[model samples]
Target chain A: AQSVAQPEDQVNVAEGNPLTVKCTYSVSGNPYLFWYVQYPNRGLQFLLKYITGDNLVKGSYGFEAEFNKSQTSFHLKKPSALVSDSALYFCAVRDMAGTGRRALTFGSGTRLQVQP
Target chain B: GAGVSQTPSNKVTEKGKYVELRCDPISGHTALYWYRQSLGQGPEFLIYFQGTGAADDSGLPNDRFFAVRPEGSVSTLKIQRTERGDSAVYLCASSPDPAPNEQFFGPGTRLTVL
Candidate 1:
């Protein structure tokens, strides 16, 4: 089974400071990891994904995530946080070696709170 | 081009009522998906359709939940009997292919079962 875990239910960071939202995964084979952000009453917006590429993957809205295979983690990061950056973050994983199933298994989600 | 769009941005219904949610995938998109998201939780996969066929419906919780993508374009999700547990944001997403690609999501229909 492919699954993702967001250890933190909520993360708070000051504006202009770097912020990190942690995510870990477990899959039977090579994993396709993704990050998505959802704002109030809106659908989830894709941030970035790591299928088979460099360790660090940059995404929308000045956000990025590091795919650390050894640590089984894909933590979302931002160089500088802004108040508008606050939203619900989700980490998802798909098993590349699975039975051709492309449905993503998502984590519980982490709320990112960027304080001004 | 416009992204995936779902109808009835919000729906409120009493228990035991039958409801239908519609989704219009991006033009030419071959794949469509349905998911349910509860309060404080991430979206949970419900079903996936490839073309006009249901490629994968294993994620559906029970027989009460059903979906269809006729003509390989627009899709509809039907719930037989509404329950309080079914209250959540029903999301619809679409991808260009069946491969493991990034999916574009719609604003979602907020279903409130009263």
Candidate 2:
């Protein structure tokens, strides 16, 4: 079984400041990680994914996430926060080696509040 | 191209009633998935369909929760005897293929069972 944990329920950051939403995962084998953002009444939009590449992966909307093997973490980062960045963020993980289960396990979610 | 779409954006139903939710995936997508999102929580996988066959349905909570993707394009999720606890946003997503591809999600159908 695989699971994702986002410790912070909500993160508040000021505009123009850097922001980080933390995520950690546990899986039997290697993991494929992902980050998604959901605006009000909108479906989740793919931000980025970490399959098997550079630890630092860049994504849409100037967002990025670092895959730390030792710590089992994939924390989303942004160089500077904007008010428009306020939304609900989700972290998900899929086991590379599994019983042919393609389902992704997701974290509870983190609400990012970028205040002006 | 249009993204994954789900019909009946909102649904209010009485407990014990049957309800159906629909989904239309991207034009060329061959993989479809169903997930449920509770308030304040992230989406949880319910089922996965590869083409017209259900590749995985382990996430389904119970037998009452059923889904079908006939002809491998449009999908429908059927719930029998819907319970209050079943009230949640039924989300549908799709991808070109199963592995490594990121699933594109729909706006979701918010089901409210009273």
TM-score of each: 0.98, 0.98
Model 1: per-residue Cα lDDT over B1-114, one tens digit each: 899999999999999999999999999999999999999999999999999999999999999999998799999999989899999999999999978889999999999999
Local lDDT at A86 for model 1: 96
How high is each candidate's interface RMSD, in Å?
Answer: 0.8, 0.7
Question: In model 1 chain A, where is the ten-residue run with the lowest total lDDT?
Answer: A95-104
Per-residue C-alpha lDDT of model 2 across residues A4-114, encoded as one tens digit per residue: 999999999999999999999999899999999999999999999999979999999999999999999999999999999999999999999856368788999999999
lDDT of each: 0.94, 0.95
- In model 2, the runs with Cα more than 4 Å from the true position are A98-100
Error of 1 at B85 (Å): 1.0
Q: On residues B34-104, what C-alpha lDDT tens digit does candidate 2 reach at each position?
A: 99999998999999999999999999999999999989999999999999999999999999998778999
Which number leads on lDDT? 2
Q: What lDDT tens digits, residue by residue, belong to model 1 across residues A34-54?
A: 999999988989999998979
In candidate 1, the residue pairs with backbone N, CA or C atoms under 3 Å apart (3 or more residues apart, or in different chains) clash, namely none
Q: How much is the TM-score of the A chain of model 2?
A: 0.97
**Which ranges of candidate 1 are over 4 A from the true structure?**
A98-100
Candidate 2: give its CA RMSD in angstroms: 0.8
Clash list (residue pairs), candidate 2: none
Top-scoring candidate (TM-score): 2
